[model samples]
Target chain A: MSSALHTVSATDTLAGRVLHDTGVAVAECYQCGKCSAGCPLADEMDITPSQILRMLQLEMPELDDEVLRSHTIWLCLTCEMCYARCPKEIDLPKVMDSLRAESLRRKVAHPKARDIIAFHKSFLDSIRTCGRLYEILLIVAYKVRTRHLLQDLLMAPKLFVRGKLNPIPELIRGRSHMARIFQRAQRKDG
Target chain B: MTMKMGFYPGCSLKGSSREFNESLCAVMDKLGVELEEVPDWNCCGATAAHNLNHALSLSLPARILALAEGAGMQEIAVPCSACYSRLVMTRHELQENEALKAEIADIIEMDLALNAVPINVIQALDRALEGASLESLVVAPLAYKVACYYGCLMVRPPKVLRFDQPEDPMTMDRMMERVGAEPIDWAFKVECCGAGFSVSRTDLVAKLCKPIVTDAVKRGAEALIVACPMCQSNLDMRRCAIKGMSEAEAHIPVLYITQAIGLALGIDRKDLGLQRHLVKVALPRRAVVGA
Candidate 1:
């Protein structure tokens, strides 16, 4: 609970870019504490949701980088609980989402939350290839990436026995079209 | 009595939660609503796409909406809450920002009509079966108490989803009552089930699932009911790791709302995919036809 704002006048232009991109009124947050108070994952976050907004208000790129890289951004479930309870109607989940996108673009990874990053990357990779998720492949890819192969091992047998896990993903006819969309998105970003 | 609507059974329904897909189709088929699959549908970009790339999220869902529109469906039913949220949110974004919509169109390389609105399974059920006689359809009434868990995405960011009351939604509860199941009043109805983190952060998901599972059990709920695949998989599959849960408490069945409805409608247990759950599900004594 750092009360003093860490203002950095040098980063105002970058801060303006964030505000324009997210359309969040970072200044209107007022650090009312309502958002964090209602957030389900606030206790696990390095900085509270209210504090994230406060950092944005201060426009400190260094603090912004830390915030973006903290496990908090990836840990956010995007559940919208904070947004629902916020008096200012700030969409904390959306803010977290935008920050996460920024984190990816800047190649900033949360050391503690790498598994989440890996999972997200693996998920998008699955979509890019098959146009839809192949559950078995996604699990294997994630397990290989995280190297936690034994984790949730018991459930897989039961899932397979129960016919929940399909050995193959039904490939949609428009996979090439989907690949084109991903390419265009990445090209525009570069 | 027959009405046609497009069904977008996102990846989860097609793979991990085939039971939800089966039960929904079975229930709808019984009700005489024809659900045509939105042909050549791809992933909806879900939470991952949105967090990693803005344009990809919008483009992935926009393509599906465009396909639904091309097939002449004014509205399509997205059973998975995450997919429903992505579709609804993308549509909302496209409607608000013409520039972004144009950009997304350029990337997706398709002219989306943006008229194929998205509706969650519950909302779709309400519309298609409006005023239908459910009282006669209940061959096996689910008389036991259940907790209706909405999870997060189905009805949140109220302005964007605009589906149900964000804080204290009761659509699922009301639907439960139609099948003679009493939906208990609980605090964590709209709580987060730590979705998408099921594989990445199973520990955190178990911790987050604590309140929802404990509250339901503490409130005398025989089962927990849900619509979202992530919520179902997390709460059901991760029951072993949930804090303050005992073997007895862990045995509480996590049922899809559609599965519960399917039970009430006397659809065969096999047809509803009830065997697919990690936690074995057995209908309560009251749910038996001649009980």
Candidate 2:
């Protein structure tokens, strides 16, 4: 049985990349299910937090693809509940962050993650345009991208009446500085 | 002589949750604590940055801290817990990893000493209230029962934040007590309120926040007190969706810790931006004393 068993190297698997990117060792996860048990969104996830780690631990390419394409990565709110409760001190949120990035890079993100990704992109675009977040701009961009124009139409006028919705973007004098920061970060990551 | 401290309001304070910023400033002013807004501050990149590019996440917050440091500000009060988490985590990460620190410095085109420490609303209030009893400052004590909601970012990943007990934090509860508000020991005090998904996944947020609101109301909490702007928006703005998820109606008003303190200090409701809430701040008028 010992001779028939094959050992997979840590440096050559999805877990290795996760470890390299997030410094979270998936191999250290012992499938205790403690993370899944504590996760607030475990039931909603396509795969539980511990299962994501388990897939990485298995060192299988197909399992890795499934993990990346799973809605679990995008659905994660990154509340850090799993990490906070994990006995092994595994940083599951960091792992989720890395996995989401990888999923986006590989174009294997789940179809259900479109709205979530659209919102994130719109949020970043608003920041890149204005030095700070412009709520109206973010909402407009998100609505345009998702084409969910009528989703929150009622909330706008109410917010406007309450002075919660600012009509104009609050531009910072260091707008160019903000743009350069985004440019540099994208260049480095790209 | 008024004590001066740097303030980083982030985006929410400028827009959707302006009430939080107004109330926070009001409370601080009453305590003779003058807040100096950080000059030319930018966004902290929030959930979008970290979820997509790790480099950008560190760079955005590093730039904010570097700007604060250059302005000679030693400590900054970050009222938004999401921004607070990002700034504090960036400082911790950069301090531990020299290579990443240098990279972030290069990206932001600023020095990376990380001298400016980020303190959440609770910590800032604690500092402002030091050596003085909160009861002494309360002109009108709040007589209603409240559930002090800490929510995720304020006190989670306990290793990094190191603010209070992660699971059952009592800092906010104690502050509520000082203002004569009865804080009930309820579950979901530190639960996640579907943080950034308030916009993109409103349905999910409603599903997640329902239990929190339900528990608070079921436990006889007259209101839910929060320190994070995201939690306030999720619990307040998404009340309709939460209502749709259940047959029972839960209309408990979500109050920011600063707003609650401001009320206790007899600050004007309009000045505190109390009228901006989606669910009306209709805590029983009978609870107001000496008004």
Best DockQ among the predictions, by candidate number: 2
The residue ranges of model 1 lying beyond 4 angstroms of the native Cα positions read: A1-14, B287-291
| Residue pairs clashing, model 1 | none
In model 2, what are the clashing residue pairs, if there are any? none
Give the lowest summed-lDDT range of ten residues in model 2 chain B: B242-251
Error of 1 at B30 (Å): 0.5
TM-score, candidate number 2: 0.96
* Each model's Cα RMSD: 3.4, 2.9
lDDT value, candidate 2, whole model = 0.89
TM-score of chain A of each: 0.89, 0.92
**Which numbered prediction scores highest in TM-score against the true structure?**
2
Model 1 per-residue lDDT tens digits across residues A3-114: 2342323424445555566666566677889888888889999888888888777666688777777878887888888888888787777778778877787778688888
Sequence-dependent TM-score of model 1? 0.95
Model 1 per-residue lDDT at A133: 91
